[model samples]
Target: MQLEDMTLEELKRLRKDVEKAIETYEARQLSEARAKLEAQAKELGYSLETIAGVSKTGSAKRLPKYRHPDNPTLTWTGRGRKPKWFIDALESGYEKKYLEI
Candidate 1:
């Protein structure tokens, strides 16, 4: 069937079918990858969660290393993205030492 010859409704239906196929394909691929990784982790004497640094509850949280200068309540663990307040303080010439808790 030629897409150029299909009506708008047929085109929409085809698009939906294509999306479903892509999703199923991606899900199968992801499951296979996870199973392979789990097997590899088991062979190395470690569970997949331990190899991935994850706990049953969740990943462990790091301690906060920096605090907002003006707000005592606002603090950051200095891990992921820097908070806006942290960035603003650095831009305004406030050294990291000044923000250390």
Candidate 2:
């Protein structure tokens, strides 16, 4: 069907189908590449994970850099999003140094 003749809904559907096809194509390509690499690594008597130094176990937990003044139990590593208590403390004029562990 001609692009000019297709209705708005049809055009939107076509766009969505195109996007999904692209994603599927890319994922299949990546899977094939990974499999080929794994096969090559196995032939060399080493797995890809070992050559890449990737561990199955998760990384160590980050220790808290800031602690709640009112409740010492509540703490934050100050890496990701700020906790509600931390936000409240900052809003109430509490400096970051005052919350340090």
lDDT of 2 at 42: 99
Where model 1 places Cα greater than 4 Å from the true spot, the runs are: 1-58
Clashing pairs in 2: none
Give per-residue CA lDDT, model 2, range 1-101, as digits (tens): 89999999999989866654543453345446667888999999998777777654558465556767666678797888999998997786566655665
Q: Write the per-residue lDDT of candidate 1 for residues 19-94, one digit (tens) a residue.
A: 5454345334544666798899999999987877866554666546676766657889788899999899789656
RMSD of 1: 16.5
Residue 32 in model 2: shift from native, Å?
A: 54
What is the model-wide C-alpha lDDT for candidate 1? 0.71
**Can you tell me which runs of candidate 2 are displaced by over 4 Å?**
1-58
